[model samples]
Target: MSTEAEYVRIDDGVLEITLSTAAKGTSLDFAGVAAGTAALAELGADIGAVLLTGAGPNFCAGGDIRDFAAAQDRSAHLYQLADTLHIFVRALDSAPVPVVAAVHGWAAGAGMSLVCAADIAVGGPGTRLRPAYPGVGLSPDGGMSWTLPRLVGAAKAREILLTDAVLDAAEAQRLGILARLTENDEAVLDNARALARTLARGPRASYTSIRALLSRSATATLGEQLDAERDAIGAAAGSPTGREGVDAFLAKRAPDYSGLN
Candidate 1:
């Protein structure tokens, strides 16, 4: 709704969410975080997947230092900003529809956190992800600490967080921070969109169930995870999409998943 972010319902159930700040640095202030949160919350029932990207040169440069300095009550100002960003990050995790981040140039601080929150990330050749918090005499926020450790292991995540390590596209990909890489920014977004479209057409219940299991894996014990997986798989098997897939296989025909939710 604001220039901070643009929300578009691209046909075929894909929601294209792009950071829209025109600033050269492209850092998000409090308003931008709130705007993004609102945009994500507005995803309708018709929407089946989301593709997140950036406008112009860089993806995002993290918090706008200028905005922070200009605030009269810096502490309260930051509290509000972080709170809003936290909500957006939580929404990304709980979203029924899967999300993909199409990242290029820079994804710093909260920007990098957003990428980490996505179900998948596609990075462009020029992508460089880093955390700007340590450089600013602050610590990581927006779930960066939690996401990165799970992503690249605790030792590497500690090095990244404490040392302001910059992860180039290749390194990020190798570390599993990026799901795929493209030759350029356009290709990055294009690939992400294609992935989103495919996900949109997939069995909704199965996709959501898989996401739910993964979300709980970190805290769940082996037995707990096994139980969760068993339940999820059983539910999926009973779903219309699952039945249709079985019937299609038996008939030697393409499954009509269009009948699924």
Candidate 2:
């Protein structure tokens, strides 16, 4: 892989995906997006969690505006760009393990979308977010329209997107956008990595089921969700990990999940 593509690596059952490029901003161009897509596609059963971070002054300033400006056929160009980005976003969403993000500096445009997509986000005191699409005279993409509403509710999402409001770390945390807030930029990644490692040691299959159940609860009726939960709990109880957990509790010892996953 090229230097630009060396953005993913697995360590101790955690897949760490760094979003970076040689470009001016931390925003992903075609190369970075493609690398991310490939990395997520190659996730294996041994991988128990994912940690997403950005390199440079910002988490991600959004898509490549310079590339957008350089496009001869702007409409077609943006269409392809958004389509490719959605593929990576979908992979991130569907990954069986929990996903965490270390967000520092300005997370604008697509970067904001990513913060919304992460299952958990750790932000620093300097973290800020903006729906940069409106400022660029475009609508939201990369599932921002879908994910933002789920994170902050429809009315708040509408207001923020329509106004292109900038969200500071405290406000973002209050809105449930950032799960944790660090004292400084350096601590953001450390805390997120620690959280990812903790999650990596958990029951991976149970986490997958929990993710699916919560995602489905958004669109499913109460009755439908209840039924789904019933099935999931039943399956979990019958699994080896579940048995180990119960045995460990009864024996007053810690469960050994390392051998299972």
Candidate 3:
């Protein structure tokens, strides 16, 4: 699976998505979007977790500004580009397994959007995030407008994007953008990979249920959320994965979830 993938690799039940371009920087160009979409689509139920990272200093620098600048019809080109990028972004959002990101250096524009969509983001001292769209005379894409407010609240998301605020590692962690912080910038990716592997060894169905319930809670009334949770928990408790987890707990042994998910 890894050999056929242009920007993704699957190993030890974890899919690592390397968002890197030939220039050694992460950019949401046509190739990157297409590669990411295909990689995510092909994973199916083969993996238990997805890890997102970059190949260079920055996680993602944003869109391919050079391509956008060179386009004859900038409006039409940008519209199509953004629309396609959204498909990849939505795949990350709706992935059955957990999505983790190793956010280092700069996560600007679309990069920041990806960080927002991640279930868990690991960063380091040098990590910085910015909503760079306004600087390019554009609005948010990749569901940034929707995910940011959920992470940092509506007012803060508004201020951050409108003012183009740059969030350093500490600030981003405090604001819940980053779920974990490593010792330094270089440790971010390694730590995130370890976390993804750890999650891959757990109950995949439970994780999916948790992700779905939390996402639904964003707009669900208290009663609605309670009902949803009840249904999810009931289903999980009756699943094969759930039975193995319980048996392992009672026997004080490690659960083998390898074939369960």
Name the candidate that leads on lDDT: 2
Runs with alpha carbons beyond 4 Å of true place in candidate 1: 1-5, 29-32
- Comparing candidate 2 with candidate 3, which one achieves the higher TM-score? 2
| Candidate scoring better on lDDT of 2 and 3 | 2
Please give the clash total of every predicted structure, in order. Answer: 0, 0, 0
lDDT of 2 by residue, 89-116 (tens): 9999889999998898989998898889
Each prediction's whole-model lDDT (CA): 0.82, 0.88, 0.87
Please name the candidate that would achieve the greatest TM-score relative to the true structure: 2
| Runs of candidate 2 exceeding 4 Å displacement | none
Report clash pairs, candidate 3.
none
lDDT of candidate 3 over 1-261, digit per residue (tens): 223366778887898877755464567445655776787887767688999887777898888888889999999998997888889988887888999999988899988998999999999999999999989899999899999999999999999999999999999999999999999898998899999999988899999999899888989999999999999989888999999999999999999888899
The CA lDDT at 9 in model 2 is 73
Residues forming the 10-long window of minimal summed lDDT in candidate 1? 1-10
Clashing pairs in 2: none
